[model samples]
Target: MGQQKTKKIEKEEPIKEEVKKPAEKIEEKKPEVKPAAKPKKAKAPRVRGQKWTAAKEKIGQKDYVIEEAIELAKSTNNAKFDASVEVHINFQLAKKSKEPIRGMVKLPHGTGKKLNVAIADDKLIEEITKTKKTPFDVLLAKTEDLAKLTKIAKILGPKGLMPSEKSGTLTADPKKTLEELNKGKISYKTDQFGILHQILGKISWDDKKLVENYQTMLSV
Candidate 1:
């Protein structure tokens, strides 16, 4: 056995606990939003012609009956050129009435104006293209030709020159229809606002003729 060595004892160190820091307060940010605005309607342009101004002045604020309205419309003829007399009727519709009021009247004396007529047959399409200006006031087309006229609907619709079956302007025999139209066969319809507007006759027409025409329409 070798000589005995003295045994050394080492003490273990004590573990220290880490101190916890208080949690910091943070503020959340929110996004700002704005509401969209509504669009405004544009006002109709005022009439600038002097004669038209005079015509407006002739029209009274109060409503006029059929006879009196015809007289007023005649008096309002201040145009340098011959002006057609027009009657605008406002109706107090019943709350329950949803159907539109529509009818046609053939003036005995005629409207005293010649309507430029256009036959919308395939054979006549070439004739339409040749005209630089829209020379026709009334366009007559058969059911078969209506599809072809669709190409020019945008141009015709705005002018109220588009012939529709609803107006009885779209006929099977366009030639006969054209003759009747030329003889002052007027068609009218009430607008969305429940107002009816139509030409009575030319301002140059005799008062008796105007009255007769008005009475004929009223009877309808």
Candidate 2:
């Protein structure tokens, strides 16, 4: 009886050892965790219109004044069609301005491009909504019609076609404004980037005409 009990105890010890071996093997086979990879930064899109690269480089880095810039700009216009001359002025306004400087001026010479004008009314509002595109370059509105056109503000605002009180496009009296606009008049305002850009004249015009037009814009 003693010898049988001894044999049974020895067999139970080996069985227990066999059961623990699998658990030890599972722990040894566990996978090692690695740190996550970082995301790559996005690159800015390249600017379009490579045709003006050489022309712009030729203008050089020198700070040319109004007169010298006009001549240089005229000389550099190598487009097949006549390029329009523009007067762009940088203002010292802060990024978050309480009272932004905005003004309208009547240039002696008109913008070379013919602009389609429209008076804002119920009929015109219906006409504009009927089409996907708004056909007019300038929109004139009175006090009564101004609130009515708010529905279409999203459409016209981005195109810079939305008439505002500050720009004098939205007015109680549009007749005088129309006459002034017909006589080479335009509005100039400092943009969000603090730059005022206005169409001065065409490159085909005489340098004298450009200078005079630029001076008129400067006066405004």
Candidate 3:
């Protein structure tokens, strides 16, 4: 018998397939935060002028008589122009009192101001509306013109020029009111701060005249 040649088949290894994997997700970086800044320092207060300081030194802590005060005011005045002599009176009224402190004063010598006066008539109202100009400082109205003034109340009211019975600007006789105004009949009232401010006259006026006006205003 011939030797049997058995063919042995080698076992082939299974083919290894290279499987692809999913990519990893990337993370985003956050922004950096900063601390708050400090506040700036405040500026120093203003310093008064040498002239003003010199003048201030003249006034004392003690209350001065009216005459001395007026003289001191005149002496302290550094202005070259003839400045007005102003008066300010503070009132200690009962807070509960509802009455308003207001009245008209006919100064012996007029308040150096030359007020442009106007009559609040139908024609004046039309002219003011047409021109869009309020050339007058004072407005006097008659009973007949009171109705016409309503058309321009928004115009005159805010300017403190509106005519009213309480203000003594509304009257039956316009002529009399004009004369009184020309004669320096000025109105005054306690301000919201409970102080009354008025001008006596120009400093150039005689001390005697200033004193008289001051006395008259004090009397009221």
Candidate 4:
């Protein structure tokens, strides 16, 4: 009986040790299982065209000539349509020199539409009237006479003929102004943000016409 009891006790002790060893191993392995790392976020792609808001913000209170402005428009792909050179001259008195600077130029290709001009002088009005079958739609003696002129501000303003000081159209030189009108000279003002917008010429215009118009604008 004593020999049997000793053998049984030894077996029981071995079984207990085996169970304890497995439990210890399970506890030790728990801390080694870490959480997986998260993936990084992707960045957005840049837009191809320039932002109008951004351009306006950058041009504030700065005086940019028609030539510089045209170059910028071409390079940035902002303003390219008809032969129109729009510029934003600085608001400073010094920047507004007494000498007349050319404000806008139009190509022979036309702006793809007829221009409606209101002449401040009766002589110019009669001269424009003789071209009754010409491409122009309207010709008047007073600026305030045409309601349509005021109505088409968006179309004409960007085309640089809103009669504002910025456009140089509100002038006393009837002959010179009429000549420019016939030649497709328009003007536009920079908004509060100082960004001036205008067309140069149609894509169909020849290199010579483009160069001539470009030179004319630069001289202004």
Candidate 5:
């Protein structure tokens, strides 16, 4: 027996199994949505009081003469205390003359209001600076005393009590001005819009008196 050729049995190597990874899933992005806006509410109508409604009814759509207007004003008045009868006059000025219309009016029957008039003097100035109180409504000054008033202009100017020649508050004779102011002398001037507002009288006055005042104001 020839020595069996030692055929070494060659061992076959085992094959390695490859692990497959699952394909990654792609996520689709969705757009974000917004909430809808709410609708706005409607506003309520203005409500008028019973007295105001009644008064409006009396003042119907019609142009009233001075006499009729005065009667209506008094009738429509509903104030607990006496109310003033006021007149608002609108002026159509020439385009060339836009200068403010100003002057004084002397009503035949004095305005029901009382005016406290004072003549500026050394004593009055001393009293005002010391007390810081303005006791008078209308101030009148003689020409000589006007220079002295500069000291207190800060106080009187704001109050419209400062004396000036244009307003006829500054004069050579204060006695005459006081006399005029005493006899229903009310000063008036147009606003920038050329409208004049004045108190004719109280609602309690008779129709004749109110009408007279209205006519007089119209004349101006």
Candidate 6:
């Protein structure tokens, strides 16, 4: 009986060893966890005018022309303006149109700079003083006087403020002219190709203001 018991105990030991081996193998095969991935940083967009290619792209994409361009200018958000500004317009008039379709508007917003106005007639000056109770920045007695006109030409010519007979702003009718002036009617001249050009105002205005001015120019 003792010998039979010894053999049975030896067989049971082998079964226990087999179970321990499987547990150790399971622990060795277990995988280690890795860290999570981080997000990448985004790049900033390029600024306008920084590159020649960007400038060309901007100009090419712009669609505003003539009065619409003026309106866009008025709508700009810039708060300050230079003493003088130059504006250009391209207009296509009907071939047979008898009346002049191009003119300038001074705008109630002013030119974003001080202006020296020269009036030809004494009566107009008197009326401006009497009714408006104000004197113009500068005045010229002879509208056609080349010498007097030449003196101020250097100052006003490049600035686009010099009065010309072609613009129709220099007229005998002070009351009518002043009425328009108060209502934002100024003057404008045309290029060699009959395209109207004038300084509307500063570039600091908002988009809506520019659009209004542009529409007014178109209507005129």
Model 1 lDDT per residue over 1-220, tens place: 9999998888888888898999988877776677777778888887598877777777848877667877786676556887888766777567567666775568888887777788887656655555534677777888778888876677778787777887777889888887877787877787767778877788888888888887777765
User: CA lDDT of each candidate?
Assistant: 0.75, 0.79, 0.85, 0.48, 0.87, 0.52
Supply the global lDDT for candidate 1. Answer: 0.75
- Report the Cα lDDT for candidate 6: 0.52
TM-scores of all models? Answer: 0.61, 0.70, 0.76, 0.32, 0.72, 0.42
lDDT of 3 by residue, 1-220 (tens): 8999999999999999999899888887787777777888898999999989999998857898788988998999999999999999988777776666777889998888888998877778999888867999888889777888888888888888888887788889978989998898887778766778989998888887788888888987
Per-residue lDDT of candidate 5, residues 79-161 (tens digit)? 99988999999897766677878778888777798988999989999999888799988899998888899989999988878
Candidate 4 minimal-lDDT segment of 10 residues: 132-141
lDDT of 4: 0.48
Root-mean-square deviation (CA) per prediction? 7.2, 9.4, 10.5, 19.8, 13.2, 25.4
Q: Runs in model 6 with CA error above 4 Å?
A: 1-53, 61-87, 93-110, 121-166, 173-183
Q: For this target, which candidate reaches the highest TM-score against the unseen true structure?
A: 3
Compose the digit string of candidate 6's lDDT tens values, residues 122-200: 4554454356433454333334444444544555555544555566544555456655565566665565566776555
- Of the pair 3 and 5, which is ahead by TM-score? 3
lDDT of 4 by residue, 1-220 (tens): 4565444444455444433444444444556767888877776775644577666665666666644554555544455554443323344333445543335455554443456666544444344345423223333223443443454445444543445443555554545776776666555334454344444564444445544655554444
Model 2 over residues 105-200: C-alpha lDDT tens digits? 777778776778888888878776777478888998886677888878878898978888998898888877888888887877777777888888
lDDT of 2 at 45: 88
Error of 5 at 193 (Å): 2.2
* Candidate 6 or 4, higher lDDT: 6
